[model samples]
Target: MGIVLFALLLVAVVLLEVNDSFLNPQFYSDTLRDADIYNFALNDLPRSALDEARLIAPQYIDPSLDENPLVSAGLTTGDFVAALNRALPPEWVQDMVEQVLDEPGDYITGERDDFSTRIQAGDRVVLVVEEIKTLTRQADAYNLLFEQVIFPNIEDALETELPFGIDVTAERVAEAVRRVVPPEWVQANVEAALNAVTPYVVGETDTFEVEVQLSERVDVALEEIKSILLESDAYDLVYDEVVEPIIKDALGPTVALPFNITISRVEITDALREVAPAQWVQEQAELIVDATGQYVTQETDSLNIDIDLRDNKIAARDVLVRLAREQFDRVANDLPACSNSQLGSLVTSGLTSLPECMPSGGTAIEDQVRGVVSDTINSLQRQIEDAVDTALLAQIPDTLTFTDQTLKDQLAASGASDNADLLDDVRRIIGEGWTYTDQDLRADLLDFDSQDSVDLLDDVRSFLSDGWVFTEQDLREQIGDADPDVLAKLDDGRRIFKQARTWRFLVYFPVLILVVIIAFLGGRAWWGRVAWAAAYLTISAAAIWITFGPVYSALSGGGIDRARQEAIDSIEPNHDFANTQALIIDKAIDTGAFIIDGFAAGVATNAIIVFVIGMLILSAAIVWPRLSEYLYK
Candidate 1:
C-alpha cells in the first residue's frame, strides 16, 4: 500500500511539471515571442543594439507590424533691453561722424601725367589741379568743400585704407608746410617747381614720376599711428577744424556768405574756353558740361551750380578723383622700407588724427548668425531618435521569422518524441537555462534566476549561451525518457544559478517506496504502513514550504505585474510624439507586459498547487498519528 501511495505521488509531480511548463501553450516559441514585443517599446533604442535574426515574422501575421523583436540592443535670449541700448552696435554713430571729417597724409611719389615735362624717377609728381583751380578761383562750393570737408575728410583715408608696405607721412608734411610757408609762396613755388622738375614744356601726353625713401622714424611711427588711427575718435575736433571753419568761412559772422559767391555755368564755360585747344572742342566741351550739370543739379536738388566746364584736357569730377588717387598712390610707391625702429620717439612723436578714426571692433557677424542654432538643435534630437528607431526596427519581421524557423528546425532534429509540442517543451526548458540533472528537469521551479528586475531573456540567453540547440542536444541525450543517468564526467560549465532540491517530489517518492518495502519485509501491519506514510507526508509539508516557496519566487521573477508596469508606466505618453510612433510603442509595451505576467502567474500557480497538496498530506499525517495506537492494538 505504501509503494502504491508512492507511485501516486510520482504521478502527481509529473502532472504538475507537465501542466506548469511542458504542456503550457505560452512556452511555445511563437507564444513566448510576445514578451519580446513589449520591451522593445518602452526603452529607447538609440543607445541599444539590434537583434539580427528576428527581422522577419511568419507570413501568417502582418508582414510589417507582427514581428516580435528582441531589441537585443546593446544599445534665449534677452530681448532688446529697453530697446535702444542694444538696438545697434556702439560704434555706429562714431563711424558716421568720422566719415564726414577725414584725416590727412604725407604725399609720396609714383607716376602722373605732367604735360609740362618728361618725368623721371626722384622728381616730385606735382598734381596739377586745373579744375580745383577753376573752382577755387570762382568761389565754387566744390572748391570750398575741397579746402574743408573733402580735404580734411580724406587726410589719411588712402593711408588707412591701403595696408600695403608703403608707410607715408603726408598728414605731417601738410601740417609742416602749412605752418612754415605762405599759401601764395607754395603755389608760386609749386608752379616753378613743376617747370624746374621737368625738361620740357607742358603738352598733351606727358607723364610725371618721382622716387622717395622711407625714413625709419616714419615706418616705426606709422605702425603705431596705424594702430592708433584704427580707433581714433575726434568728431568734435573734426567739427571744429573742418566744419567750423567751413561755417565761419562761408558766413563770416552770419549764416549767409559775406560776399555773393556766384559760381555760375557762364563763369565755368568761359574759363574752359580760355584754355580750350581749339574752337570746336571748346564748343563741344561746353555742351557736354552743360548737359551733365543740368542733369546732376536736377536729380540732387542741392548745390545748384548748373555750370559746364568741359575741357579737352579733363572733366573736373573725373580728373580730380583720378589725380587724388594718383597722389595717394605716389606716397605709397617708391617708398624704401624704413632702416630700423631704434628711433622710437622720432617716429611716434608725429602721428595724429587723435580725434577722428578709432580702432575697434568692426562689426559682429554672429549677431545675425545665432538665431538658427535653436532650430538646428531640436531637429538633430529628433533625427537621432528616428534613425535609431529605423535601424533597430528595420528588419524586425525577418529577425522574428528567422528565429522561429531556426528554433523549429532544431526542435525537429532532436528526435526525442513524436509529440511536437512535448519536444518543443523540452526544448524551451533546456533553452531557458542549462538543465543540471533529471532532478532539475522534474523540478519546474529550478529553471529561473534568484534575483528580481533582471531581464529574463538576456539572463537566460547569457547562461544558456551555448544556445538552445547545443545545450538542448547534450541535455536531451542525458535525460532520455527511459532510464536517465544524471552523473558521469559532465562539464559543469562556468555559471550555475540554482539546483533542484535533492529531496524533491521524485526522490521522496522513491524513498517512500523503499520504506514500504522494508515494512512489508519486516511484517509491519498495513495500518502501520499507512500511519508512517501519513506521518512522512506531515514532515514533507515543511520541506515543501522551505524548498518550494523561494523556488517559485525565483521562477516568477518575470511577473506579469512587473512587466505590465514596465510597459504601462513607460507609456506615460509623450504628448507631442507622432501618433503612429506612440501607438506602436504603447502596444508593444502592453504585449510584453501581459506576456511576462502570464509567465509569472503560470509559475506561481504551479507552486501554489504543489504547496496545497503538501498541506493536504499534512492533515492526513495528523489523522494517521491519532490512529496509530488504535491500529497497533
Candidate 2:
C-alpha cells in the first residue's frame, strides 16, 4: 500500500506540474505578454514585411514606363520604405496585437470572431500613401530630385546646347553694345551736338575767331598743300579767283590782294581759315566723339580745329591738288570765285589738302570700333553668367532652399517641358493622397465575393492579400477537404484547453491530498510522519531541479539557436522573400527562447523554495526527539 501510494503520489505530482506549466491560461498570458516577445513581433515582423515589400516593388512597377514612377517623383526605394514604416508604425502593430490577445481564452477556444475586425489592413495602405505625400511635401525632398536628376541634366544641356564660346560677328557685337549702351542715349548726345553746331552751320558767325591745333600728319599735309599751291602753274589764277575772293568775303568784301605782287602762303592760309565750314567740322567732330564714347568716357563733346600756316616744299603735288579740290567744292559753294567752275575746282582742291578738311567717312569707322568693343564686353558677360549658373547648380545638391516651384521653373526654362509636366503630376499625386474611405476599401478590396474592381485600391488589396490581410473564412477555404478525424481532434484540443482553466484546481487539490496521504501511510510517530513528508518534498524538489535546471538547460541551451539557424538555412538563397522569412523565423525563435528561459527560471526558483522548506522540516524532525525528552524530564 505504501509503495502503491508513493507511485500514486508521483503521478499526482506530474499532473500538477503539467497543469501549472502547460494548461494554465495565466502561463500563456504571461508568455505572450513577455516584453521580448512583444517587442520582437512589433519591431522585427514589420521590418521583415517592409524588406519584402521593397524587393517586390520593382516587379510591380509598370514596364512600359522608362523609369520607376516613384523615382520620377523624387522618391528612392529606401525613402518609400521609410515612409511606409512611418505610416504603419510599430505602435500600431502593438495595439493590434494587444487587441487580438486581450482575451487569450477566447482565442484558445477559437471563439474570437473579432480578430479580423481589430485593424483594417486597407487603413495601412491609405496611411502609407498619406505618409509618402507628407514626405514629398517637405522642402528637402525637392533638393534630392534637383541634386540627383534635374540639375545635373540641366547642366549637361547648358554645356552642350548653349553657345559658350560665341562667334564674334558684327551683328552680335552690335547687339552686345546696344544692350550695354542704348542707341537712344547716343541719339540724345547727337541732338545736343546739333544744337551746339547749328549757329556755325547756318552762318550766324562768319568771322568767328577760333584757335586751331592739328595732328602732326595733318600739319605736314597742310604745309605741303600750301607749297604746292605757291609753286603751281595755276597759282596766279587761284590767287585772283579763289584766295582773294575768300579774303574779301571774310573782310566784308573790302579786303584786296596786291596781284602781280607775290602772295605769301601764310596770308592765303589765314584768309582760308576765316571762311572755313564750321558746320561740316562740327558734324565730323560729333561722329568721332560718338565712336570714342562707346569705348571710353568723353569729358566734353568739343572740336579743336587745326591748320598749318607755314612754307614747305611740295613732294606729292598731284595728291595735294586732289585733296584740296575735294575740300574746296564742299566749303566754297557760296564764294564768288566758286561760281567759275575751273577756278572753284582749283580752290576746293587746295582746301581739301588741309588736314582740317579731311572727310569723316560717315559711320564706317564708328561701326568698326563699336564691333570690336562689343565683342569683348559680350564674351566677358557670357563667362560671368556661366560661372554664376555653375555655382548656383553646385549649391543646389546640398541646400534645402531650392523648392519645388523653383525646380519646375528651371526645368521649363531649360526646355525640359516633359520633365516639368512629370513634376506637376507627382505633386498632384502627393497632394491628392489617400482619398479612399473605409467604404471605398470594402467595396474595392474586402467585397471580393462580387465582381472584382480594377483600380489602384484593388491592386493594393491584391498585393496585401498575398500575406497580410486574411480572414477566418480564408483559413476555412484553405483547409477545405481536410481529414474529419484531424478536424475532430483539433476541436477536442480546443475544448480541453478552454476547460483546463477551471479544471486546473482539481488537479492541484488531488496532488495536495495525495502528498498528505503518502506521508501518513509511510510513518507512525509524529517525527516519522514529518520525516516522510520532508522526504517527499525533497524528492519532488530534486526532480524539479534536475528536470528544469541542468537537464532543461542542457537540452534548450543551444537548441533554439540551432533551430533558428536551421530554419534560416532552409530558405532559398538570393531571394528577398526568403530572406525576410528567415528574419521572421530568427526573431520568433529568439522570442520563444526568452519566454522559455523565464519559465525555466521560475521553475528553478520554485524548486529552491521547496528544497529549503524540506530541509527546515527535516531539521525540526531531527531535533524533536531531544526536545521531547527534555520536556519529559
Candidate 3:
C-alpha cells in the first residue's frame, strides 16, 4: 500500500512539473521575451532563407544589373533630335511644314496633297490668312510700281516737243520718232499694248465699231481743223502756245515727279517685306496652329514607350537617339549634302509646329519633340515602378511555397555541380517544396518564420522611400559553419511553439488542485507526503532543462555570427531574384540571431516556471503539518 501510494504521488509530481516545462502556455509565452532563445533562432534565418531562396531568381528578391539597363541609355536632347530626325526624316518634316504653310483655311475642303490636307479638318483659318496676305502683297507691289515708275514716265513723254514744217508735219514727225525708237523699246511698247488690250480681248465689247467711229472722228477733225492739225508748222505753233503750258500746269506735279523718280526693284521688294498680314489673316493662322498642336499633342499622348531591360538606361529614347546620331554624325563628316546649320533647321522643323513659347524663327518643333519624349518617360516611370513592386512582392509568393528546381538550376549555373553534398544539404535545410507568403515573411523565425526577407529587404525600402531603418548589430553573434541537417531539425523542433499552447494556464490550475488533493488524502503525515511529492516534481522539471539545453544551443548556432552564410553563396543574380545581397545577408544574420535568442528565452521561461512551482510545492509541504494540526484542534 505504501509503495503504491508513493507511485501515485510520483505520477502527480510528474504531471505538475513535466507539463509545465514542455507543454505549458504561460511558460512559452514568457519564453518569447527570453534573450538567449531569441539569439539562437536568429542564427538560423540566413541559412534557412538562402537554402530556399537560391533556387528561385535573383530579380525576385535581389537587385540585378539587368534591371538597371537604363543607366547607360544616356539620352539627351541632342540625341533625341538626331534620332527622331532619322526615324521620321527631316526632309519629310520640311516638306510637311511647307505644305502646312501653304494650306488654305478649310483643310478638309481642299485637295489631299495640298497644305490644307495636312492641317486639321475644321481649320480654314490658315487658308484665309494666306489668301489675304497674297492679295495684300500684290496690291502693295502694284502701288509701288505705278506711283514711282510708270505714271511719271507717261506724264513726261506727253510733254515732249514736236517739230512743225511743211515736210515735217505732225504725222511725219510722229513717223520719224517711231523710226528712231529702239526695236527693243518698240517690242516693249507692243507688249504693253497687248497687256492693256487683254481685258478688252476677253470681254464682250465692240472692238470694230469703236475703231470705225474713232476713224470717222479723226477724218472730221482733219476736215474741220486742217490748218492747225494737218499743217505741221501751224500745229507746232499752237501746241507751244496752248497745249504745252496747260498740260504742264495740270499734270506735271502729279505724273512728272514719278517719271523722274529713279528707284531700284530691290527697294520695292524690301518695302513690301515690311508689311505684315492683316489681322483677319492672323486669326486664320492661329486656327491652323491650334489644329496642328491638337494633332501633335494627341500623337505624343498616344506614344507608347518603355525602357528596355537591355537598354542599360532609364529609357530607350537615349540609346536609340545616340545610335542614330552617331550614324548621322559619321556620315556628316563626309559633308553629306546638307550643311550643319541647314541640318539643324531641318531637324527642328521636322520635330513639330511652332510653339507658343517660341518665335517664328525659334526651334519649337525640337523643344516639342523633347517634351513629348520626356512626357513618355515620366509616364513609363510609374508603370515600371509598379511592375517592379509586383515582381518583388511576387518573389515572396501569395501562398507559402519553395522548390529545389531553382536551387538545382542555381547549382548548375555556378559550375558547382561536382559538389554532390551541397544539393542534399540544401534539400535537407529547405525540404523539397514549400509554398510561403507575406504572413511567413512577417512571422518570427524562431516562432516559425522570421519574416525571412524582412531583414535584408528592409534596405530595399531605402531606395524606394525615405524612411527609418534598424541599425544596431555589433554584438549580435551569427551562426558560423553550422550543419544543414542539424539546423533543419531545429526548424522542425520549433513546432513546440504550437504544442506548448494547447492547454492554457487555466487548464493547468485544475490539474494543480487535483495533485494537491490527492497528496493530502494519501498520507496522514502531511509534511512527509508533500516533501516527497515536491522532490519528484523538481527532478522531472530539472530533467527537461538538461535534455533541451543542447538542442536549443545548436539551434542558436553556438553564438557565432556567420554560421550558415556560405549557404547563400549558391544563389545567382537574375531577373527574378534581384536584391541587395550583402545587405540581405547581414540583415538575415541579425534577424535570425534575434529570433533564436527569443526561443531560448521562451525555453528558459518554461524552465523557470517548473523550478518555481517545484519550490512552492516543497515550501507548502513544510507548512502542511501545522495547518492540519490547527484544523484538527
Candidate 4:
C-alpha cells in the first residue's frame, strides 16, 4: 500500500512539474531570454525576413516592365531592400522582437486577449522612398546604374540580336556601310565621268571662273568625303575592322577594342557638310550642338537607337539638293563646252559613238545629265537617309542626364505606361522631401476608430487588402470544417492552465498528507517508520530516474535530429542568407534540444540524489541495530 501510494505521489509530482513547465509564464519568459534564442531572433531573423521579401518582391511588379532595361537593371528589389536595411534602425527590430516576446507571456497570463503585436511598416516604407529620392538626386548613382547594369544589357542585346553578326562595334558598323556603299563603285563612276569630260577641256584658261571640270570636281568631292569620314572617327573604325583579324592573330586575343564608339547628330552633320554642304543641315546640327541632348540620350556603351526619319526630312532633302548641285555644276562647266574639232578627233580615234558633239537645236548635254542625276538622287533619297541615320543613331553617347522625368518619358514611349504611372505615383508620394510621418501614414493608409486609435490587426489587414472587402463569411469559409470538440478541449485546457498555480497548491497538500499517512502506517517504531519511508523513497526515485533519463532520451533522440534537419531543409536555396539562416535554425534547434536535455538531466540527478539519501537511511536502520547488539555482546 505504501509503495503504491509513493508511486502515485511520484506520478502526481511529474505531471504537475511538466504542466508548470509548459503553462507557467515564467518558464517561457526565462527560456526565451536565454542567450542563444534571444540573440538568434534579435540579430538574424529580421535580415533573413528582408532578404526573403526582396526575393519575392519581383512577382508583385507590373509584368509589362519585366523586359524593361530599367526594371531588369536599375529597378531591383535587392537594391531597394539593401537601401531599406541601411536606413532602418537596428533598435526598431529589437523593439519589435521585445514586444513580441512579451506577448507570449501576456497571453499565457491572461493579460492580453490575442497573441499579436503591431509592427508599423509604414515608417519603413517612407524611409525606403526617401532612400530612393536620395539615390535619384545623386549623379554617381545614376552613372553606376548606366555603366554597370544598363550598358552591359544593351551591349549583350546588340551583340546577339544585331544583323551585323556577333560584333556590334563601330568597326562592324563601318564594314556594313562599306558593303552597302562600296568605295570601288564611287571610284569607278568618277573615272568614267572624268573620261567623258576630258575631250571638252581643249585648254586651260585663266579666264574660266570654274578651274576644275566634272572629273576633277568629283575627285575633290571624294577627298572631301574621305576627310569627313576621318573627322567623324569612321576612318579609324573602318581601319580597325580591316586590320582586326591580323591584330587578333598576332596578339593572340589579348587586344581589346580601342574605345566605345558613339556618333551623335553633330558628327553626322559635319560628315554630311564635307560630302554635300547645305544650309539646313548646318542649322539642324547647330540646334543639336549639345550632343548630350535629352531626346537623343544614350544610357549604354553600345548603340541602341529607334529612328524616325520623318523628324529630319528637311535635313535629308538638303543633303540630296547639295549632292545634285555639285554634280550639275560639274557637268555644266565641262560637258557643253566640247569643241567640234575634239569631237572629230574622238570619232577618228574610235572613241565616239554619237552623231554630233552636242544635241541639235541648242539642246545642252549638261541639262539632260543634271536632270537624270537629280531624278536618280530623288528616287533613292529614302534609302540614303536611312543608311546615314542608322549609322548616326547607332553611335552611343558617352554621357546622359538621368532624371525621373526622362525615365518616365522613356518608359511610356517604350509601351511601359503602367511603370511610368507607377513612377509618377512614387514621385507624388515622395514629393520634394521626407514629408510623410507615422501619424500621416496611420491616417491615410490605416483604419481608425472613433477615438482615432488604430486596431493593429485590423489596420494591417485593411492596408494589405488595398481596399478589398473581406467579411466574416470569407473568414468562416477559409476556416471551414473546424472540429467543435477540439475547440471545447482547447477552452478547457486554457481554463486549466489559467488555474494551474492554485491547482499546484492543492496537489502539493494532498501529496504531503499522503506521505505522512504512509509514514505512520508503514511501521510502529520511529526507526521502522524511517526504514519504511526510505524504502518507498528509494523505489520512487529509481522509477523517476529510469523514466526521465534513458527512457525519455530513447524516445526523443532521433526525432530531435530529424526535426533539426527538416527545418534546415525547408529554407529556400535561392535565399541570399540561406546558409546563415540554416545555421541559425540549426543552432536554435540545438539550443532547444540542449534545454530539454538539461531539464531531463536535472530531473535524473535529483532522482539519483533522493535515491542515495533513501538508501543511506535504510542501510542505517538495518545496520544500527546489528552494530549495537555486537557492541553489547
What TM-score does each of the candidates earn?
A: 0.19, 0.40, 0.22, 0.42
Model 1 TM-score, 2 decimals: 0.19
Best by lDDT: 4
* Cα RMSD for candidates in order: 44.9, 28.9, 45.6, 23.3
lDDT of 2 by residue, 340-383 (tens): 34333433443212122222124664344334433543444443
For candidate 3, what is the lDDT?
A: 0.38
Q: What is the alpha-carbon RMSD of candidate 1 to the true structure? A: 44.9
Residue-wise C-alpha lDDT for candidate 4, range 1-633, written one tens digit per residue: 656655765665565666556555556556655644645554456556544444544425433223333343444544544565555655565555565556655454444445655554544544544575554443234444444444455545444422101224544444343443344443444344333322222221111121212322333333433333334443222222212222223334331111122323333343333443344333332222222122212222222222222434334445544443444344433444336565445435532122223312244644553344445445454444454344332232222223345435445554556756775444333233224333543465454444345455345444433333434334334445476565556556556666765566465465556656667889897778778777887788788889888998899889998998899899998766687778788878877887787677766776787679879989997788789889999
1-633: candidate 1 lDDT, tens digit per residue: 444544454444544454434233224433434344322322332112122223424232334322232211111001111122222222332332222221100000001111121112111112233322332333333333334444454464433422112234556534433433334443454444344433221222223322221221233333343333222322221222222233333324321111111222222223323344454443432332333223322322222221222232243323323333343334333333322342233234422211111112223422222223223333443433343234211211211111222223333443312433454443333234222332332243434543332344234433333222223334336556443444222222101101222123453455456556644554466655544554544344334444444664566555644764564555445432334344455555556545555554544455455456655654665577678768998
Deviation (Å) of 11 in candidate 1: 16
**Which of the numbered candidates is closest to the native, going by highest TM-score?**
4
**Judged by lDDT relative to the true structure, which candidate is superior, 3 or 4?**
4
Better-scoring candidate (lDDT), 1 or 2: 2
What C-alpha lDDT do the candidate models reach, one value each?
0.34, 0.47, 0.38, 0.48
Alpha-carbon deviation at 328 in model 2, angstroms: 66
lDDT for 556 in candidate 2 is 93
lDDT of 2: 0.47
Off by over 4 Å in 3: 1-503, 506-524, 546-551, 558-563, 573-579, 585-593, 620-633
RMSD over all Cα atoms, model 2? 28.9
Q: How do these models rank on TM-score, best leading? A: 4, 2, 3, 1
